[model samples]
Target: MSLNSLRERLIERLTPAGAWTPDGLPDRSDYDLNPDAPRSPRTLRPAAVLVPVIARPEGASVLLTRRSDTLASHTGQIAFPGGRLDPGETAVQAALREAREEVALDPASVEVLGVGDGYETVTGFLVTPVIGWLAEPPVVSPSPDEVAEVFEAPWDFLMDPANHRRDFLEPESGPRRWFWAMPWRERYIWGATASILRALHARLYGDEARPGAAVGEDAA
Candidate 1:
């Protein structure tokens, strides 16, 4: 799709009043919460992230972060700019706050389109992914205490199916485990974050376009 068309579609998809469930997306049961078993009584704190997309002169790219190792959970994983929700804050407010804190991104420059479905993490946090369009590029500096690095990935590459790989690992006694992998340069994007991206791709594009296919190509 042309950039203009893509922007229009994204705006329509992000309408505030529209449905935000990942119903027609890939079945995340293989990766998301367990339904039959009772989960431990953990606090369902609302968390949010800014899935910021920059429409660069060359092409569109999505902002991402490499977390600092000091973090107790998901310490060094590749992720979006986000964190726990604070008291009296809405999901969008939390997302903007986190982005500003982690990456020095200006909240005023982001046009929040809509939010994706909430994904419950095994660690007990319910994360809401907020999709936003960056109106203008802003200077970004990573917070040494919370962010290891901040970078951008070509949206076309991420949206393509060819670059996504399904990998498995064998636990101590259980069968092999499965998860999504979308690698770029030295960074490996996987686990809950990858699952969220997969769902987003399915929603924006179609399911037939698996992950990994558009890695090296220009946007169609």
Candidate 2:
């Protein structure tokens, strides 16, 4: 799809930027896959992530990053550029700020399209996925303290339902943990990052495009 069409579709389908509430629970969440899991915390810390879609001649690509291995949590995981919202900051502001801090993504270069469904993470964060359109590919410099590497995953590969993998792990305690996974080349994309991508796919296409869990064995 062309950038114009994609932007129009996103604006039409995504939640309006004005509709996002700091604590309002969106229809989508991590619990979507783990329906039988325990309830989420009553007070969810609000966080925002930028879903940067860069315009490429072949097609659009999504910008992603590998978190620094030195981080206290989720180290080396493939993720979008984002973090907890600062005091009085809106989702858009927070997303842009986090992107700038993590990958040197210029806020001025991104045209904020709209926001997707709010995702409540298993770790007690209410994440708002802010979609941004980049007219051209960006020159991103990853911060050594926070990001190990910055890369682009083809938008087509990410949006294709066939590439969405149902993966899970049986924890020592509690029920098995299930989450979305999309393995690209040498990177393993899963957890909240993959879940957000899956949610976006469902929104753009339809729930009919969502696949059933792979049976008999782990698919991660």
Candidate 3:
């Protein structure tokens, strides 16, 4: 598909009022994406992540970040630029603010597309993904305290369902926890971030694609 068609598709998916979990998009394991999928009972805090799509002449790509290893939580993980919402902030506001704080991405450089579904993480975060479109790539410098690196991943690779892998781990005290993970080269984009991407893919491709991968690992 051409970039225009892809952009149109995103617009269609995001333009509606509260377009997050449209008919085709999957919900959290809490919302019955699968009855059998394990759900987290821990209290979930509200957070927002910016899904920044940089529109390029050749193709569009989504910008991602690697969290600084020094952070207390989710350190050294591949993630979107985001964090817990501040006092009385909307998802868009939080997302934009977090993007700016983490990666030095100017909010003015982004055109708000719309929001996507609320993704609940096993780590106890109710994450709202705020999608944004950038006419062109902007200069983004990582904040050393929060971000270890900032890079772009092809939208086509992410939107493709074939790249969505089923990953799971068996904890010593409970049942196996299954989550989506998209391994791009060496980086493991898994957990809530990967699931959110899968939700977007579900909305875009629906029944047109089939799953093609599974990987396993041990968890504590």
Per-residue CA lDDT of model 1 for 1-220, tens digit only, reads: 4455556656665536144432223234334433444456655666778899886767778899999999887889999998887877777888899999999999998988887657777566778788988856668999999999999988876776677788866779755667788998889988777777777776666533532333223243
Worst 10 residues of 3 by lDDT: 211-220
The candidate that wins on TM-score is: 2
What is candidate 3's TM-score against the reference? 0.83
| Candidate 2 accuracy as lDDT | 0.85
RMSD of each: 4.2, 5.7, 6.8
Each candidate: what lDDT?
0.73, 0.85, 0.76
- Give per-model TM-scores: 0.82, 0.90, 0.83
Candidate 1: segments with Cα more than 4 A from true spot: 15-43, 173-175, 207-220
Q: The CA-based lDDT of model 3 is what?
A: 0.76
What does candidate 3's lDDT look like per residue over 17-63, in tens digits?
25433223324643333456566556668888999988777677889
Residue 62 lDDT, candidate 2, scale 0-100: 92
Candidate No. with top lDDT? 2
**What digit string (tens of lDDT, one per residue) describes model 2 on residues 1-220?**
3566667767888888877778677667778889999894578899999999987766778999999999999999999999999999999999999999999999999988889878888888989999998988899999999999999988768887788999998999999988899999999999999989988877876743333221101111
What lDDT score goes with residue 153 in model 1? 85
